[model samples]
Target: MTRIAINGFGRIGRSILRMLLTSRAEDGFELVAINDIAPLQSCAYLFAYDSVFGPYPGDVRHEDGAIIVDGRRIPFHSVADIREVDLQGVDVLLECTGAEGGRAEVERGLEAGAGSVLISGPSDVADMTVVLGANEADLGAHRVVSNASCTTNALAPLLALLDSHWGVESGHMTTVHCYTGSQPTVDKPKANLVRSRAAALSMVPTTTSAARLIGAVLPGLDGRIEARAVRVPSASVSCIDLTVQTRKPARVDEVNAVLEQAAESPVFGWITLPLVSTDLRMRSESIVMSGRETSVSVGGLLRVFGWYDNEWGFSNRMLDVAGLMAAR
Candidate 1:
């Protein structure tokens, strides 16, 4: 089994742990250690109960020098610096600390004896950026591999299918994203202006690096895609609205057929359902094309809607990438 360690315990980290625990019998991974800056009490409480995802299906407590979630007795260690953490026999140490993860953070895990480090968020210094269904083939032998952001993962499969079928000209993507931990439940002191306002009370427009990150996974889209995000009050699942003028006039049926074909290919993670955000809470795929809502305007403009359990799906993709690396 591939021994794994996590360097953070945020939404993504806990989701990964939850997935691994639930799939222990089939997954080729083993959770050996969890290193985070949070206190043991905080980690215990947060891991056992998630407001967005509901309580874990099992009991949780601290025992035997570790936090036992359900029947798992994975050891936990709290440290101030990444370098201070230990990963003696770990095959992959997930750098789940978001912006705090990059080459430097990954190197710390390697120095302490991890076989490889997988970053759950974007990193400019990582060996390569992987968007599973799009360009996972771009992976290299380097130790640090960033899985990119949740938005980027959601965009890849949809964009790839459309671009291949109708030839994308230029695209504008608007993601109606749900609020994350980065936002405050109530208006409070924070930077970056609009985001500081009450998250549960307003729809806040924001910028995104997903467009730029897309080029890393799909080079053809380097300068052809622009993205914007609107943070909404929804607690979990989110969707992406992609508008594009195809190089060729796309017919409605043709577009539906294209997505339908992609969805049939399980590896691409496309689903042709008209489900809403809440319906996608525990979905494991990176993106599921909402065929029922997909439409092609008479003026030759194409609009595609894709839904994802942002937290759960992104974690699933991250695990897929790590699993690939482990197999290699």
Candidate 2:
């Protein structure tokens, strides 16, 4: 079995942990260890709040700093000193921490003899930044990989489609994303300049590194894309709006057909819904991929809209990519 370790226990980290607990048996992977700066006793409460495995999924218990699920006891430890733990047998170390701390976590995993370190969030030190199916092949020679942000992952397939079929001259994207744990529920001053404001009652304009990371995944798109982000009040789902300048103007149907084909492509197969929307009621939260695919559409002026459950959707893709890498 593939032994895995997780760092951090926040929204994405906790979701990744739950994903592993529920998916490992089927995927031939196992959660060997989990670390966070927070106390282990809080894990039970965190797990209870997780939408994926709310309030303990099946025969789960917390005892002696470990979580027992279906007779498997997964140990939890403090991340303050990651070197204290023996990760020699861990096949993959998932850094879902989303902190600048990720760089240190990857270093520790390498020192502990992990074959690969897969970061669930963006990181500056990763050997390569990937958006799963988009540039997964780039991970072949890398020991440490960073799965670009959820917004980037959700938009990659769509951008690839446009570039392949209509051909993109330049593009701009804005992700209306749900508020994360890092954001405050009420207005408060934070260390970061932009995120210091409250997320509950405001739309926070922020810059995104997704565009640069997207360029890494699709080298053909270098210097052709720009991105921005907005932190919204919703807790789970997020949406992306992209405006592209095509090399030559094409009919709306032609654009939709291209997206539909890319959605069916094995490499970019996550795009499930392709349509044109004139309804103002089309909401970011209402969009979801019921099947193993993504939703996409062509709006006026070569614009497109895509939606995703930032946490669940991206976490699912992370595991899928990890599975493929492990097999190789």
Candidate 3:
């Protein structure tokens, strides 16, 4: 069995762990250890309401600097110094800390003898940044890989589709991203005063690196994309708005047809067709990719919408890439 070690127990990290436990039983991947500086009780409390696992129905006991989960007895390691943890037998190390300190963490994992390390957030030092189904083929053994943010994954297929079918001239995107843990629920005085306000009541402007990183996955799109972000009240699943200038002017129906075709392709089963506004209102929380319809102007511009469960959905894609690496 392939042993996997997960670093960080944040939202994305815990979601990835839950996903592996739920799906990897038949895939030969064993989640061996979870590492975080936070106390085991705190970690357990955070995941207490996990929809699938419900609550952690086990006691957390300390053993050899690791927290053991009762019954399952999975070790949750707490290492003050990440560099000292041994990962000699770990096949894959998933770093979901979303910290700028990713480079150091990844380096430590590689030095500990992990065969490969998959990062869930953006990092400047990874061997390559991968978007599952878009550029996963670029990953290989004994290398560090980073999965671009969920917004990037949500936009990649669309960009790839346009570039493949009708050449994309240029594009702009604005993501009304849902509030994340990084934002506060109530206004407070903080060092980073800009984001210190409550996200639930504000529409805060922010910067996004998705456009810059998306080009890495699709080289043909270099210097042709730009993005801006807004923090909204929603807790999960953010929305994306894209405007693209196609090589040739096309009707709304024609563009929608291309998206529908791409979504139906075996390669992009995650992309779903356009839905009516009423339909979306009915299943607002369903894990469907939004933006089935398109609005094409007389010019070559086309606008589209895309939605994703930033945490669960992106974690699913990350796991898919990690499993692929494990298979090799």
| Highest lDDT model number | 1
Off by over 4 Å in 2: 51-54, 102-105, 191-194, 265-300
Model 1 Cα shift for residue 166 (angstroms): 1.8
Measured on C-alpha atoms, candidate 2 has an lDDT of 0.70
Regions of model 1 farther than 4 Å from truth: 23-25, 99-102, 265-274
What TM-score does candidate 2 reach?
A: 0.84
lDDT of 3 by residue, 1-328 (tens): 7678888888877776655545444766778778898988777667655543355444544555554555355678777555567888888788877777746756888887788888887778898888865777777654788888878877776788777777889999998887877888899887767689998898888878786888898888988999889888766567778899988776766766766666654234324455432233212121344445457766668887766666766777766777787789
Report the Cα RMSD per candidate: 1.8, 4.8, 4.0
Please list the C-alpha lDDT of all candidates, in the order they appear: 0.83, 0.70, 0.71
lDDT of 1 by residue, 114-187 (tens): 88888888888888888888887768676788889999998976788788888899999999999988888888
Error of 1 at 43 (Å): 0.9
Q: Which stretches of candidate 3 lie over 4 Å from their true place?
A: 23-25, 50-70, 102-104, 189-193, 264-288
Candidate 2, after superposition: displacement of residue 278 in Å? Answer: 20
* Tens digits of per-residue lDDT for model 2, 1-328: 7677877777766766666666544777777888888867787567756553346476666787787666778898876766777888777777776767656656887787677888887888988887754677667767788888878887776777677777888889998887887788776787776798878778888877787888788889888899999998766677788888888676655665655555554333224345322221112222332222223235434777666767766777677667665666
lDDT agreement of model 1 with the native:
0.83
For model 2, name the residue pairs that clash: 270-293, 270-294, 271-294, 272-294
